[model samples]
Target: MNILLWHVHGSWTTAFVQGPHTYLVPVTPDRGPDGRGRAETFTWPSSVREVTPAELAAAPVDLVVLQRPHEERLAAEWLGGRRPGRDVPAVYLEHNTPRGDVPDSRHPAADRPDLTLVHVTHFNRLFWDNGSTRTAVIEHGVVDPGHLYTGRLPRAAVVVNEPVRRRRYVGTDLLPGLSEAVPLDVFGMRTEGLAEELGLPADRCRSADLPQRQLHAAMAERRLYLHPVRWTSLGLSLLEAMHLGMPVVVLATTEAVEAVPAGTGVLSTRPEELARAARRYLADPEAAARDGARARQAALERYGLKRFLDDWERLITEVRS
Candidate 1:
């Protein structure tokens, strides 16, 4: 299948293009948000090809995978005014949870019966009002980072992009308290001033914007992975960390409750409880490693790339047919 999709989320796309299909990604001169072309940080297979606006306009697209709401209009313009889902097969992949009016939050494509709304988590599917639009929950799948856990460093590791800006939503507010239990090594974009903003010393809450490989390597050295996000469809970073064989301490919100099962690590709604769990993991390397192994196994069984790609293949075939 010739799948037309934008490079919206890098990590998710990295695993997606590994499937048995020709992925057509958009490329602009600037390679901006709508047209990131190919991923630089993560490796992709030859099946993923970059198509310019003019090229896409003429190319035959088997299925259109829409991530952002604006992509519907963008796809029409790029496809020479072909209406997605109506003129061509299309699916709207909702990555984030609804923002306003929890119960009444209607999806933008809710009224479109021709399009299928794909939610990354069951929580998102339950929360979103799809109206007459068809919906499916595919969950999340990640390319395994391998069993890289060393737990050599006695600190905790966190991967939250723009932690300072997202604040409590990304669980940045819980970091300071967790830092009291175990020092945190933060990694992601726009996290440079996080230490100062959180009123913590530089050593306690150090931040770096390492590439994906380096980030995984650095995170593996830590005693445990910290996922404090209060609300999200599901975080790919959390799954990636588990695949890296790092024991996690996550806030039991959104889809995290399903991702981080009991005995894999600690899952708590209380910040203090999660902090205490982090401290325990930091203190006991053997315990951390035991849980980390469970985490790796669970991640592979639930979020493996093969299953993800298979699900997508079936969905695309059904939609296209």
Candidate 2:
């Protein structure tokens, strides 16, 4: 199948294009958001091809995979007015928790009979009112970075983009108190200057923006992973951390409670409690390694690359048929 999708979420797309089907990604001169085309930081399979809007009009697309709301219109306009879910089969992959009104949030595809709505987490499936739109939950699948954890650094690793702007939503506010117990090293886009912004010493908390390969290596050295995101469908970074054989300390909110099972690490609603858990892991290398082993096992069982690709393939066949 020739699947059409944008390069919106890098980690998810990295896992997605590894499937059997040929992927058609849109590219522009500037490589703008709607048309970033191929990935640069993360490696992708050869099956993923980059094409311009003009080329897409003549291309044979089996199905269009919609991520952002504007993609619905953009796909149709670029594909010679072949409207998605009408001329071409389409599915809206919702990668976020509803933004407004909490549980009362209505999905953009709500009541749209033509397009099927797919969510990355079950938590998003329950919260977003899909109404008449067909819905499915495929969870998350990540390319395992293997069990590279050393736990040599007595600190916590966090991955969040633009943490200063997203702030509370991505759990930047919780880091200060948590850092008092265990130092934090944050990784992602625009993560530099986080320590200065938070008024913390360079040792207590520091940030760096590294490529996926380097980021994974850096994270593996940390004692534990910290997921402070207050609301999100699910973060690929948390799963990636587990795949790296690092124990985790996550806030028991949204889909995190389901992702981080007991014994894998600690899940708490309180910041102080999370701090204590981080301290325990930082002090005991053996205990951290034990929990990290369990974390790697659980991640393999649930979010392995093979399983994730298989699920997507099945959905593609169904949608195409």
Candidate 3:
């Protein structure tokens, strides 16, 4: 079957592509917001092509998976009219919180009969309704486990895709004080100017994407992973952190509250409370290791690629039917 997984967003489509059928991903020239085009270098087994409303409407695409609602509105006009399979069986995936530009209708992409609304986390599924029929809940997953495993490192780490200078909704802002209590390491593309605000010179923090192998090593070396996501859906980085046996410290917001069990880690929005929790783990390294072990066990049990693939296969099969 020819499955067209169209999402301006990247990095989250690995599971669907690992299936038994052919997979097609659209390529974008630039990776920025304007770079709506898919990447030509994508080496997924099935195929790659440029996606536009015209091609989407014309192709006998079996299943069209959307990562955002805006994609549906763009393709719908070209779909001629939405239908179950002929034009495409479309599924809209809500990957993050709806921002200021969009309203809070949970099923913002459900306007089309052919479109199935899917939420990345059950906690996020609450903000929408479908004639009392709730949207499907599929948690986002981490693809590479090799990067996360048992290791003995003393630092607390937060691996945001971008650098942290000032405290943002994510862990960057508060991490300094947390790090002051215990050493902290922040990694990703540099935040550039925020170092002054953060008061940590850029050099003190690693501000670049580590190569895959190095990244895993870095994750394992850390005993703690700070995930202070004030806004947005559950972060996959948290799951990756769990997989690596890094006991986590996350704010009890959105899905973070559910992802971290008491044994796995602590979830509190209060800085002092979080600081206390950090102190507990820092003071008792063995307890931190125990929590890290539990976290790894939990992640391997629930968020493995096989489990994610199985759930996605069921949905794709439903679309095909």
Cα lDDT of model 3 by residue, 89-188, tens digit: 7677777765554345535564556556788887767755433432688776666565354446566676775544324646576666666665666665
Candidate 2 yields a Cα-based lDDT of 0.92
Stretches of model 2 off by over 4 angstroms after superposition: none
TM-score for candidate 1: 0.98
User: How close to the true structure is residue 31 of candidate 2, measured as C-alpha lDDT?
Assistant: 93
Clashing pairs in 2: none
In angstroms, the error of model 3 at 310 is 1.4
lDDT of 3: 0.66
Backbone Cα, N, C clashes tallied per candidate: 0, 0, 10
Checking candidate 3 for backbone clashes, the offending pairs are: 26-38, 27-37, 27-38, 27-39, 28-37, 28-38, 28-39, 106-128, 153-221, 167-173
Tell me each candidate's RMSD, in Å, in order: 0.9, 0.8, 3.7
Candidate 1 C-alpha lDDT tens digits along 1-321: 789999999998898888888999999999999888999988899999999999988899889999988999999999998889989899999999988999689999897879999999999989988899889989788988899999999999999999988997899988888899999999998899999999999889999999887889999999999999997778899999999999999999999999898889999999999989998997889999999999999999999999998998889888988
RMSD of 1: 0.9
